[model samples]
Target: MRKKKVLLVLLLISQFIVLAQDYKFGKVSKEELKEKFYPLDSTADAAYLYKSRRTYYDYVQNMGFQLVTEIHERVKIYTKEGFDMATKAIVYYTPESGEDERVNSIKGYTFNLVGNKIQKEKLSQKSVFREQLNRFRTSKKITMPKIKEGSVIEIKYKLISPYIQSINDFHFQHHIPVKKLEAQVEIPEYFVFNKKTIGYYNVKLIKESKGGRIGDTQYGVNVFKFDEDNIPALKNDEPFVSNISNYRAGMKFELTQMNFISIGGDFKTFSSSWSNVSKQIYKSSSFGGELSKSGYYKDDLEKILTENTTETDKLLAVFQFIKGKVKWNEYYGIYSDKGVRKAYKDRVGNVADINLMLTSMLRSAGLNANPVLVSTRNNGVPVFPTIDGFNYVISMVELTNRGYVLLDATEPYSTPNILPKRTLNWNGRKITKEGNSSWVKLTSSKPAAEDNNLMVTISKDLLVTGLFRTKYFNLSGLTYRKNHNHLTEESVINSLEEKNNLEIEEFKLINENLIGKPVIRNVKFSSDNLVESINGKIYLEPMLFLTQHTNPFKLAGRKFPVDFTTPWKVKNMVSIKIPKGYKVEKLPESIAVGLPENLGVFKFKVKESGGKINTICVLQFNNAIIAPQYYNALKDFYGQIVKKQSEKIVLVKQ
Candidate 1:
C-alpha cells in the first residue's frame, strides 16, 4: 500500500509537467486580472497587450534573445586576370530578450587554376535562443515539412553592371530564391506601396506567446510579409509560426515604418574573390586592367582647339562634341567593366560612366576639365562628404578668356553654359588632378539670355495681325530644352491648339541647335475674328504667348524653402499696322514694375508711329532661388506682369 501511494504521487507530478508544456486556451477572470490586465479597447471583446506595455516588454525581455549565424563561401578560379568585386551588407532585427547577442561565423573557400571556368558557393544558417529555466517558459519550435503537393521556389537576381555588360554571360548561377529578396526602395510621399517580390515567399512563423509580465503574447516570424503575395506556405524546409494574422491585426503600420526579418539562405559560387574573376568575356574592362589613359584636359584640348580656333569657337566645339557624342542611360553605379573606352565606342552609358568618359576624353583633348560629382534633386540633398551621397556627375571646363562652363553631354538640347537639372544638388564636389576633391558652387551668374522680337502687319480682311518671339538662355534655356525632347512638335502643337480652342495654320521650328545658344522657336498661326466686336469697335489681347507670366505660388503659408535656380529675361513685341479702314482709338496704359536688386522686372509700352501701333512687353527674373519670406513679394511681382500682359488695345472702325 505504501509503494502504490508513492507511485501515484509521482504519476500526478509527471502529468502536471506535461500539462504545463502543452498549449492552453483560457479566459482570465475579472478578479484575477483586475490590476494585472485590462481591456484592449472599448470595441474589443477580450483584453490584449497594450502598446506601451508591449514596447516595454519588447525592450526589456524580447530583446534579450541570442542569435547565431554562419556563412560559408567558396570561389573558383578562372584565369590569370581576375574580376574586381566587393560585398556590402547590413543586418537589423527586434530583440526578444533583454540582452541581444549575434555571432557571425563566415568563412571563404578558394579555388585552384585546374578548371577554365570558376564556380562559387555560399552556405548560411541562423539559430535563435531564449534564456529560460524550462521549455515551458519559451514558445514551442515549429518546423515545416517537405511539400507533398505542387510547390516550387523561384529565385531571381537583379544585377546591374557599371556599364553595358551581360550578367548572364558571367555564369553566375546560385540556389533559387536568394535571401533578403526585398530591395531597400525609396518611397516618395505621393506614391503608394504596390507589390512583393519572390524572395518574400519564404517567411515562417517562429513564436506565439500571450501578453504577460513581458507583454502580450508576441508572435515572431522567420520572414517579413511585404505585399499581398508574401503569404507563406506550410510545407517548406524552414520553421515558422502561424499567428501572423493576429500580430498584424494588433499593430498599426505604414509603408515607411515597414521592415523585414533576417533569415539565412544558401548560395554557391566558384570564384572566391571578385579580383580573381575573368574579363575575357566582357566587352570592356577598365580599372581592373592596365591601360594608358589621359585625363579630361587632353581630350578637351584636342577636340576644342586647333591652329586657327578662337576662344568662342573652341568653347562651341567642345560643347557640341559633348552633346552630340554621348547618350544618357540614367543609371548610377561605380563598378562597370564597360569603362570610358567602351562607353565612347557605344556612345551610350549611365550618368557616371558617360560623364566619366566625357571627363577622360576632355583630358585627352588637352582642355582644362574636371569631374563634378553632384546629387540629383530627386535623389535628395547630400548632407556630408560620404562617397555614396553622389549619384550623378558633370564636367566643368575653364575657358582661356571666359569663366567656367558647366557641360552635360546627356542633354542634347543643353548649351555648353547650361548645367543639367541633376547638377542642382545642394552643391557639387570637384575632383581634381591631385586626387583631391572640393565643393563647387553651382549658382548661376548674371548676363544670361534676354531676347525680344515683334512683327506687326495689316491683313487684307481689315483685321490687325501681330507676331511675337521670345527666347531664353542659360538656366532658363536648359529648362525648356529638357522638356523639349520628351514630346514632338506635332504633339505640343496639338495639345496647345486643343487647349486654346484655336486652329493652327502655320507652325515651324526655326532652330534646333543646342550647343552654345538658346533654342529659337517660331510659331505662326491665325484665328478667325479673335477680337471682340462691340458698337463698331474691336478689342484684342496684347499677350498671345501661351506660357504667359503667372504666379507659381499661391499658398497662404509654407514651411519648406522655395528653390528656383534659373534666371530669365523675356521680351514680347506686338506690331499692329492699322487696317485700311480702321484706326487706333486707345492704347493700353504703359506700365513698369521692378523688384529689389533686379530680382524681377516687367515693362509694357505702346507707341503710334505712321498709323502703326507698336507694343512691347518684357519680364525678367534675375534670381534663381527665392526665400519663403519673399514669397508674397515674388507672387505680387508675377501678378503684375500677368495683368500688364493681359491688357487689351481698343480700335475703332472707320
Candidate 2:
C-alpha cells in the first residue's frame, strides 16, 4: 500500500505539471513577472508568453447566426525595441454592409516588479482610438499603459463579425518570438471549409469530431486545434523580397460550402472559379453593369472616335481622350464607386471607374477591350482563385495584328505598352464581357535605355569644364518625367548642382511635353575637384561624373532572386581633352566582360587619338530577373565595373 501510494502521488504530480504549463489570460505567474530575459532567445526584445484565439459561431436575435472570435495575448518585454508591441490594431468591416463588426470587453493590464513586489497598471479608456482605414475598413487602435523594460503586458478582446467568408487568419509566428500559441475553431456540420497552410515551416494540425450545442440544437461539430511552442520570430533579412507576407507561417479558412437543415440540407458551394467570379463581377451594379451603359459619354466619345481613322489610330485616340478626361483619385479597387456616368461628370474616380471608362471608349471605337485585374507588388501574389486576390484594374485592347496592348490611364505619362511599376507583380487575370477569362503575364517586353555624351577639357590647374547631354528612352523617360517633371527648372538645376557639387549653367530640357518622346537634358558644368594633384602627378577617374561609386549587390549571397522589373541598357560616350603640352602617362586597359549565361555584359574601351582621349562604356541586361545561383557572378560583375571606373587616369607634364 505504501509503494502504490508513492506511485499515485508521482502520477498526480506529472498531471499537475502539464496543466501548469498551459498559460491562461490574467493568470501570469510570479516567475513570468520576474523574468528578465527569455531563456531560449536572450537576444529577443520581447517574447509572447501566451497567445490564444478561439473562433466559433454565435446566434443573435436579428442576425440569426454570425461568426465570433475571441483573442487573448500576454507578452514580456525585455528591451526598448519591444515597446512597439504595445500598440494593438484590430481591423473590422466597413459600415456599408448594413451592420458593422462589433468589438467588446477589451481589457489590458501591465505588471512590473518593484522592490520585490508587483506593480499593476490598468489600461485607460482614452488610450483607445477608432479610425477609418479606408472606404471599406476601420481599425480599433490601443496603446498599452505603463509599458517598460521587463514588463509583462496582457490583453483580451472579443469580436463579433457578420462576414463568415472572411475568416480570420491565425499567425503562428510574428516579429517577436512566441513561447506558446494555441488556436482552435469549432465548425458546425452544416458548414464545410477548406483550410490552407502556407510558409516555409511545416505545422501539424489536429482535428476531432466533437459534440456541441447552439441555441437548443444539438449536433456534431469539427474542432480543429493548433498548438505550438518555441516559435522563433520571422524576419525578411533577405534581399529582393517584395512581399514578406508570402513567406509567413499562417493558416486561413476559406468557406467552400454550407448546408442548412431547414432548407432541405442541400450543400451550396461558395468557392468560385475564374469564369464564375468574372460572371458575377460583370453582373454586379458597379462593374460590368456600369460598363454596359456608356450613354453619358456618348457625345464626347462620338467626337473622339472617327470611322475614317485606322484601327491603331482610333485606339490611341480613344485612350488618350479618356486619359485626358478622367483623373485617378489614387485609390485601388475592382468596382466602380460613382458609376461611369457620374465619374464622367465629376472628372475624378477610383481605378475601376477610370479604367472601365477607358475600356468603354475603346469598344465604342470598334476595338475589343476588357478589364485586367491585377495584384500590385505590395499585394502578395495570388496563389488561389478567390475574389480577394486582385485589388487593381487596367484596360487591355486587341490590336489588328492579333497582339495585345495593356493600358493604365491612371498614370498620365504612361503609354500603350508601358505600365506603372506597381502593376508588375507576377500575372493578371483578363476578364471580358464575352466570358473569356485567362491569366496574362504582367512583365513588360520593352527595354529601358539611357544614352549620354560628355565632352570635357582639363586645364593645367586641374579645373575641368564639361558639357553633358542625356536622352532617356522608353520606360526610362516615362519614369523620369513622373519623378521630376513636377519640380521647377531652377529647382531641378539646384538639386543637380548640390548632388554633384559642381557649378551648373545653361540647363535645358527637351520634350518637356512628356508624351510619346524621349526626354533629353543638356547641362554645362565646371569642377575643380575632379582631379587630385599629388606627388607631381595628376590623378583622375576616366569616367568622371558618370562613374558608379558603389556596388548595390553588396551581399556575398542571397536567398531570393533580384528583380529589376525591366530589361535595361546604359551607353556612355566620353571625350576628354588632355591638358595642353601634357601627354597621358597611364590608362586603364580596355576589357570586355560578360555575366554567366550571357544575361548581362559590360564593355570598357579607351583610345587616344589626335591629342584627345575617348572612352566608351556600355552595360546591358538581357532580362530583368537574376536568380539566386547567379548572385555571385552578378556581384562580381558590378565589382569589376566599379574598379574599372575608379582607376586613375595619370597625366605627366612635359
Off by over 4 Å in 2: 1-52, 59-65, 73-86, 95-98, 110-121, 145-154, 173-180, 184-186, 201-209, 214-239, 259-263, 306-308, 596-598
Candidate 2's TM-score: 0.85
Residue 89 lDDT, candidate 1, scale 0-100: 30
| Ten-residue stretch with the least lDDT total in model 2 | 13-22
Q: If scored against the real structure, what TM-score would every candidate get?
A: 0.53, 0.85
Show model 1 residue runs off by greater than 4 Å: 1-319, 333-337, 446-472, 475-482, 485-489, 499-502, 545-550
Every candidate's lDDT: 0.45, 0.83
lDDT of 2 by residue, 617-644 (tens): 9999987778789999999999999999
Q: Name the lDDT of candidate 2.
A: 0.83
Would you give me the overall lDDT of model 1? 0.45
TM-score (C-alpha) between model 1 and the true structure: 0.53
